[model samples]
Target chain A: MSKVKIESEKCKGCYLCIEVCPKKCLEVSKEFNKKGYHPVEFVNDKECTGCGFCYQICPEVCIEVYK
Target chain B: MNKILSRPESLTLIQHSYCPGCGHGIIHRIIAECIDELGVREKTIGIAPVGCAVFAYDYFNFDVTEAAHGRPPAVATGIKRVLPDRVVFTYQGDGDLAAIGTNETVHAANRSENITVIFVNNAVYGMTGGQMAPTTIEKQKTATTPFGRDIKRDGYPLKVCELLAATGGAVYLERVAVNNIKNIMKTRKAIKKAFQNQIDNKGFSLVEVLSQCPVNWGMTPKESVKWMDDVFVKHFPLGVYKDI
Candidate 1:
């Protein structure tokens, strides 16, 4: 399964990654990070193509992509 | 399957200081990725401007130096002149480039200094509380321009790429945006080319990135990007202004 790991501690909750994810595998977690922002959580149930679009668009470089 | 993407090796472990959804981090990553791809990180020297990216030296792994407000091009020119072998580039924001550094920018480009320029044009003076920059679009609301920028009084936004393209020394100039995935990819390509031009001794090359200042723009990161697509691009269209 393709997946992207998000560094929750580093995420600023911009959601740009979620906007660019083709697989709909990324969602905002209810819990806030150390920075007081809602971090993204990967939804493993969905199949990810590992397009890396989220990786390219993430301003904080929080996502790491794997296929 | 293994890892498909990760942080560029040219970047440090320090987290970016830019606000969420700001484009500096993204641009910084793109530049780092390009330097890594070109295998020039070891010899690369970045000239950091006095703006939101003042801490650019901390983010980039290679050698980086700070320059006065809007003086990066001048600083980069001296560095490149002194060490012709090292890859030198300057990263400046709209206020630093088109405003305070306008003369420096014009002369550097006019002289065709063998240095790469990464011009981030978010239209406002982000670090200074969203003051009206020279590149701020017509009638755009900025901190100084509460009633919106008066085109009759303030004049049209300066098109840096187009302006520099007319100079004889500049060999390449491209304006790009980072609002969406396609534009982000295109921006990456443009940045790589700018670096490549310097390495090839092809004279001055500038890549004007239409970055997003979500916090300063008083909009969500999402809305800022959308506004860039809907309104910003209308004022400053993207594409190569010059290539020779």
Candidate 2:
């Protein structure tokens, strides 16, 4: 199984990851973290291909993808 | 995996936007090489500032954030505080750091933010028309300072390393130039140390690199190096100012 993890606190809300995700599995969650910013969340892991696009696009290095 | 001259995995294939003989390219390559050598390409987050290098996000293979002019330090602060395990760095120019963003740069150093700063001082502003910068030397003519920088009117060149060293928060501070082969090697070492400091959680670290601006300085590539060797170094002496 492939999974994506978001370090919510580190997320700067750049949305580059969301834009780069080919599968469109990630979205800015309604819930805000300690930074008071809405971080991204993976709504469906099944759609994730583990392409690492999101991992690469995340400017804050807040995302990690494991296959 | 650490090889000199070999391109770093963190750098993208696209060529930089800097002009021919520009020092920004050299500084960028040294930083990318250092990141590759440290094997932190995967964990490093770079904050791109608004300047000639504003498009740095396209050049680095690693994750990158684009911050407004002189705001890289503030953005890096937010990123590093949250992702303490990851390495965060900012590539800023003299116009951005010593001029408009002086407050952000100073406070970030005063707070000892756990991050690395690569300060490129090319004496004059490159992105915006050739203009006088905070680090511009006396008697240097720019588009704005047509009659040469007047000492009484224009302030002295800002020595970033000297200013940052006064703050106890900074763990490592060095001023280096990339005008020659020997100096390039030293600049690489200083860059590596700044990144190492971040990894060791040693607080803020900065390497002020004296760079050449042939396009803005109105000099040829070769002339730029000579100018750096003759005039730039005299004002911004190269050396490690603080190491802890």
Candidate with maximal lDDT: 1
CAPRI grade, predicted model 1: high
Which pairs clash in model 2? Answer: B10-B61
Candidate with maximal TM-score = 1
State the lDDT of candidate 1 residue by residue for B1-244, as single tens digits.
Answer: 6988999999999999899999999999999999999999899999999889999999999999999888999899899999999999999998899999999999999999999999999999988799999999888999999999998998889999989988999999999999999999999999999999999999999999999999989999999999999999999999999999
Best by DockQ: 1
TM-score attained by chain A of model 2: 0.93
RMSD of model 2 against the true structure? 14.8
Q: Please write out the lDDT profile of model 2 over residues B172-204, one tens digit for every residue.
A: 999998776668779889999899989988999
TM-score of the A chain in candidate 1: the value is 0.91
Report, for every candidate in turn, its global Cα lDDT versus the true structure: 0.93, 0.83
Instruction: Tell me the DockQ of each model, to 2 decimals.
Output: 0.88, 0.02
Worst 10 residues of 2 chain B by lDDT: B1-10
